[model samples]
Target: MTQTEAAPVTAAPVDAETYAQIVQFYSHHMQLLDNAEAEEWADGFTEDGVFAQNVKPEPTRGRDTIAASMRRGVDRLKGRDVVRRHWLSMVVADRVDADSVRTKYYAVVFETPAGGKASVYLSTTGEDTLVREDGRWRIRHRLINHDGA
Candidate 1:
């Protein structure tokens, strides 16, 4: 295959380069959230992306709304001098189509107050539908469920 041609994304497993790219994508994506860059983090999603959690009555739809929701939480934490971090691990990707991937992973969230020790805030699992937009991976839909709930 030529360098420009993508290796097929299959049920067995993606090639090393493809897997590395997925890991790199999540690393940068989560770091943005950890750093409280809400708008930029939300930009990792498609324009009509959806985020749904088990605790919420309804899913947050649209990239703009997702950013707004994140902003509210970040602002509230900042008021109390607290910082939140998200860690995603155990990622497994399945090719949904030529252009889309479904990733499932474990997530742990930590919160730290100014001069205080960090504590686990939440433990969950996330399944996301990812698509390439403009040659970048963007979330099209995300579903997160609390570990014990």
Candidate 2:
């Protein structure tokens, strides 16, 4: 209980339940995109939130625009009937507040073609962000900075 022994905790460690929800929210986003469920993917954000890919010059904002942008991309791959599985591990979470948390995790996407036995590498993130809204966790912003060339 000594003052010197206490390092004066500045950031609170995210609890297991909250941590799981954050992970689930991120996984859901990946699933929506993989399934080409554009609208569902956009719905994961807040009304005015954004989804931005750092590789792209512009970021997608608002639900309608986000959905449309995603739709365009999804349309390109729609015919392929591809499925992507997200691998999330090495998660690190920092508490912004009691209700808000910022989590960073390593992720890799494996693309599987319909009726195909082999899988191909699609993308790997730099990271993503999630927020708690309406007592439910959802992705408020995603800044996917892919490194794989």
Candidate 3:
């Protein structure tokens, strides 16, 4: 008798309720950033959260540091007349455990100058680890891998 290999088993997908919650969380997250609400954006993270980008070698640790970093970016754009928007697509969430989830999504950043058409500024894929803190889903870590970077 010949032995046959078994097909790979995949993890169960997130339920619709969980998926909707995550979507709402992400929507609020992006809106805060787009509106330059740095502190509020940071509040979406845990106290010891991490944020990293492909271009940066070091990750920003802690919510305070993350908020400051976001503020700095907002400051740079203050006088530039540029409106930045983050578009997320193809978000897939997997349950890591009872109170934690891992998500992968595609992110596209668009920039529209005053009186100008919006154009894609950056495109990247992101992996995020989210944990339930204080009965709300908060980002524990986020790693953004820029396309071609």
Steric clash count of candidate 3: 0
Clashes of each: 0, 0, 0
* Alpha carbon deviation, residue 104, candidate 3 (Å): 0.6
Please list the C-alpha lDDT of all candidates, in the order they appear. Answer: 0.87, 0.71, 0.90
* Residue 59, candidate 2: alpha-carbon lDDT: 83
Q: Clashing pairs in model 2?
A: none
Q: Candidate 3: where is the Cα deviation over 4 Å?
A: 1-10
* Candidate 3 per-residue lDDT over residues 1-149, each given as its tens digit: 13363212236567899999999999989999999999999999899999999899899999999999999999899889899998877888988788988888999999999999989999999989899889899999999999998
User: Evaluated with lDDT, which candidate comes out highest?
Assistant: 3
lDDT of 2 at 6: 41
Q: What TM-score, computed on C-alpha atoms, does each candidate reach?
A: 0.88, 0.79, 0.92
Model 1 scores a C-alpha lDDT of: 0.87
Q: List the residue pairs that clash in candidate 3.
A: none
Best by TM-score: 3
- TM-score comparison, 1 vs 2, better candidate: 1
Candidate 1 wrong stretches, greater than 4 Å: 1-12
